[model samples]
Target: MSKLRNGFIVLLAVFGFAFGSLSSVSTEAQPVRTAEAATTAQQITKINSTLSAKNKAAKKWIAMRESGRSYTAKNGNCYGRYQLLRSYLHYNYTKVNQEKTANKYVAGRYGSWTKAKSFWLSHHWY
Candidate 1:
């Protein structure tokens, strides 16, 4: 009975050690994920800041009216913050691509986000 008790104690210690090592590995991984998230957020902030204040405000207004800044927002054939036609994206739907494509489309079709917003205000779409 003493030998059995010792064996059980050894088994519990082995399991405890294995679990401790696994938890430590996961804890070490957490910082890398957090750092990556912070880097991505910083990049997004930089990209957003590139616009002039007026253009940024117009863009935000349109985004709010269209999709409320949701990256995955969809309505019929439109998608993303700008409510762009899915065909316009050629299936590339990353946030960066969405921003770039929206900028180009707004520039091409309306000359600026401000103009697009005006059009939306008058006609309910842009």
Candidate 2:
């Protein structure tokens, strides 16, 4: 009787531990989802403000090609709409900062967003 009771207790503990781990994983995932949602909203607003009306479509096309307009997008060391190196962001992943950085990078590298889009078209990367 004692061995049976001990075995039952051990089984109960294992089940409890499994349930607890699952609950914690779910709780942690919620915050990641929320952050992703907020990043998407920020990307939309920042992209609208950063690109000139004439260049908006081209810039949008580039961003879509790079990240599908997702601010939280990542590929290896590249991140965000422009696929900037993670080091360039300096841990500041805000939309305004990303837009500013992307614009500066585009201006320096391609002279304009349209040109950048052209480059991307030929090379499949910008």
- lDDT (C-alpha) at residue 6 in model 2: 100
TM-score of 2: 0.60
Q: Which digits, one per residue and each the tens of the lDDT, describe model 1 over residues 1-126? A: 999999999999999999999999999999999998888787767777768899999999999999988989989999998899999987788887788888889989999889999999999989
Q: Pick by TM-score: which candidate is best? A: 1
lDDT of 2 by residue, 1-126 (tens): 999999999999999999999999999999999999788777757656756775778888888999999888999998887789988888788777788788888889998888988899999998
By summed lDDT, the worst window of 10 consecutive residues in model 2 runs over: 46-55
Query: How many clashes in candidate 1?
Result: 0
Off by over 4 Å in 2: 1-51
* Runs off by more than 4 Å, candidate 1: 1-19, 35-39, 42-49
